[model samples]
Target chain A: MRCAEHCEVVANRPVATNQFEIEIHCPTVALHAQPGQFVQMRVQSGYEPLFSRPFSVFRRFPERGNFSVVYLVRGAFTQMLARKKPGESVFVVGPLGNRFLVAQPANQVLHLLVAGGVGAPPLYLLAEELVQTGVPRQKIVVVNGARRQDLLVCQEHFAELGVRLRTVTEDGSAGAKGKVTDALKALHGRGELSGNRCQVYTCGPTAMLEAVAKFAQKHDLPCQVSVETLMPCGLGVCLGCAVKVRTANGTDYKRACVDGPIFDATEVVWE
Target chain B: MSEVKLSVKLGPLRLQNPVLVASGTFGYGSEYADLIDLNRLGGIMVKGTTLHPRAGNPMPRMVETAAGCLNSIGLQNVGVEAFIREKLPFLRQYRCAVIVNIAGDSYEEFEQLAERLDGVEGVHALEMNISCPNQEKGGIHFGVDPEATREVVSRVRKRTRLPLIVKLSPNVTDITMTAQAAVDGGADILSLVNTFVGTAIDAKTRRFKLANITGGLSGPAIKPLALYMVWRVARAVKVPIIGMGGIMNATDAVEFLLAGASAVAVGTANYVNPHASMEILEGIEQYLREQGEKDVKHIVGTVKRCKPGNEF
Candidate 1:
């Protein structure tokens, strides 16, 4: 059951350049929140920035009764959120959208988790869960990418999870100075991944997701992507966050808030 | 203080209260059941339904502006058959009135929709959506012209015995023309000021923000205009009015009642706060009690206006 709770800020501070992670103490949300699910936060009490902002659960500490979201200060809402102090109240509605597909299929021998910039939060949670579920640390690989070194977030978190970590950046400021797909190509060339033996999970900007989807298609691997859009009501009533996907017939729009924020790569119709 | 009356009557339809969830904002009512009580509402106007299922428009469908948002959802919904089969049962379990908002590309389709839902078990009323600005055809085309509005209303009226509400478009030269026309064509009530046709542009990208190029605007940005239209339509027509557009709180709702609306529907605010409708409903009762009024009807159309030639 989804609910609206006025959560107390536990910690809200800068995690990296232009990126801040805010933790809120909401037991219901933390206890029920799954990886890739998100919470809609009402940043202020006024109407100037009317709609609540949707943020993916970066980390959920169920025992501590808290969850955190990683956000980039792009506009007024995030800017305001960045200035919030611990103990201040933030109205949140959550445990929303679908969770990442963690149940590995029999043929899938390798799990490749990809992240681009702020998109790393949900994928980080997925990596943590996979490791907890007894998936061999060697079988899981993470590709963290961003525009530059400072923008490449969550690399250390993945490293702490005892998984193989790879870093990519647009400029030569990180591990591999290329896009995430380029790193995937290098991995494939080295036979680290084989056809139909790998399962890919990615979250990032649309351009990056499209490229990853194409890579998975070419490699005959099942891939899942976490998409982002302007979601007014995370409850699916607003129907504003539309993601075009392939249907049995031509094409149709699916509500990213309900049908999924997580979607099978092959089913998404990239424009 | 005496008990305050929240119930209201709109022609043949009687509501438990005057706070309804506007069409399209509250999806089949079940979507919000966990966050708020569905039985506490005056009515639930589900998403705009067409004779056949609609896929709606392409992305991006919605964009936020100053104190408001613009959307071109194009009335995407399961066809009426699926609505009756899959959606209606969930609503039937609740005590709140079920007001189905129906849109069509032609008068024959409107008539068919009305006839199909006329005696349906859970349906309490029908809101003829001749005013949806997001659709490519049918909707606002018939709504902007007075003659077409009257013709469509009467055609649907002829087919259904349920209370009929003609929702008016605000993009016309004069909204009262269509309002009076709807009343003249046997409409039982009127829901004034559907979303105003508007658009937003991204200066950085030099592109329209919405894929539809233009979409209907809703929220507090349009509240004053919606109130003015409701006031105008109230004097022009005798039927009750369900005023909407940018009503975010109890104060906004009361202003509509003072402006001659018998009831008010909460729209865009529902997205901002799922508990908004309940909060507004509680606030309305508090307002009535503070005013020393035992009945809400005492405040309907009670705004004080200066006499002609005596204006300051």
Candidate 2:
């Protein structure tokens, strides 16, 4: 749907520096979304910076026709988006990217979670779903990293869910002082995410995703990663989102907008 | 609820909406079938292709900026043959107009591409991407230098009966001259204001953000510039103009039309909202209703622009 400059922002706030965790009332998308879906939003106005920025559905509030995404104030578009107050309306194109795997009754008893900065959004919702699906609250260990202490937001919600929240700060202000790599390495050594036949779920920056992919593969754990890409047509008309995949389908192409924002780590060329 | 008809005509092509996908962004029309409704568009313009295959520029080719984006993709494509055989079939399934955007390094290549596409099924029109004016034999906005622009436009104009649309480069000092030259050379239509030359630096790394030292800047930053060109070209040439650059909303499209374009295309917005084109069309109809107008064509070039609006 072409988002008319008319949808009221249901929730808008500063979750971090230039980063916001906001929600708008979009029943159509809420009703249509599957876990791991996304929405395309024009970060700003006019023709100069024309394209809309795509964000994953951090948390979909279907009954309320609202959803939220945590984003950094990276640029003018996002900065403009972060500045939007509740009740303001803007055009939004909708739950576009392929979603994450829904809660399935697989044999793996635990979910090893990894996130960085705003990457915490998707994992947060995934954890909520897992809790609802009878996965013990204690079974999910979330490893999150941020450059500084001020960048972390929404900690209380994850804590309230009884998840084991582990923090990695570039500086020693938070939990462990090193980085997420340090946290994962610690977990790997303790068998928390090791030879227990765990399923790993992750979404973060390219470097972090690459690191997680290597760690999961090295340990032979089943891993899936969410890929962030520049997509204009979430429906796959714009080949801007084409990413190389290691698949029999074809050697050269997979539209991240449609084929996936989430994919098996081994199937992707994690460059 | 009123059923607003979003369809409009751009020379020989008929679009379900006025929002056509800009060139160099949407590839060969078949790539995005899964995430979008292909048949529900004004038209789709594939990447710039030439006589031979092009791998395009190197990695780090695209960099995301504040309100817009910078890219030096350099027109990567698999040449016209692969596009015709592999892509068109899947694209044919869509009911919308399919406009082939052609680019070349030489007159021979442009003519070669044009001749081959003359009768391709589902190929409704040809968009001559005269963007890289200097790298090729002619120069960027081939139409910028009227003689060369006319030469290329005339050559391709003669090779195909499909409507010839020359896409103009905005890096020029005067766009209307180029717009007029394309028409003078028998261009059936004109798509104005390709990306403007721009740059972004990584202050910490002390390096350019894009692989290519300089990239084309697109989005809201270029809308006023594009609208100016459309206004100038609208009054200068009789051929229909498909204006683009930084159009993000229906108001933006309507503004471009009032500046004298027959239709408007969404370029960089594709990066933000996958359905921007469809969204703009919806916004345009919403505008027409708010304005109490029954049709949209009446607003073409209806707004009087500040004369300097076309200047760089």
Best by DockQ: 1
TM-score of each: 0.97, 0.78
Interface RMSD after interface superposition, model 2? 5.0
Query: Candidate 1: where is the Cα deviation over 4 Å?
Result: A105-108, B138-140, B306-312
TM-score of each model's chain B: 0.97, 0.91
Expressed as tens digits, the lDDT of each residue in B1-312 for candidate 2 is 565555677676677777788876666655445456777778888777777766555446666665667777666677899888887888888887788888887788889999999998989999898775324323344645777888999988889999889988887778777777788888988998888878899999999876668887777778888888888888888888999988877788898988888888887766565556777887888898888777778777788535875786
Q: What does candidate 2's lDDT look like per residue over A202-254, in tens digits?
A: 88787988888898898887788888777655655545566667757545456
Assess each model's interface with DockQ, reporting 2 decimals per model: 0.82, 0.25
Model 1 has a DockQ score of 0.82
RMSD of each: 2.2, 5.2
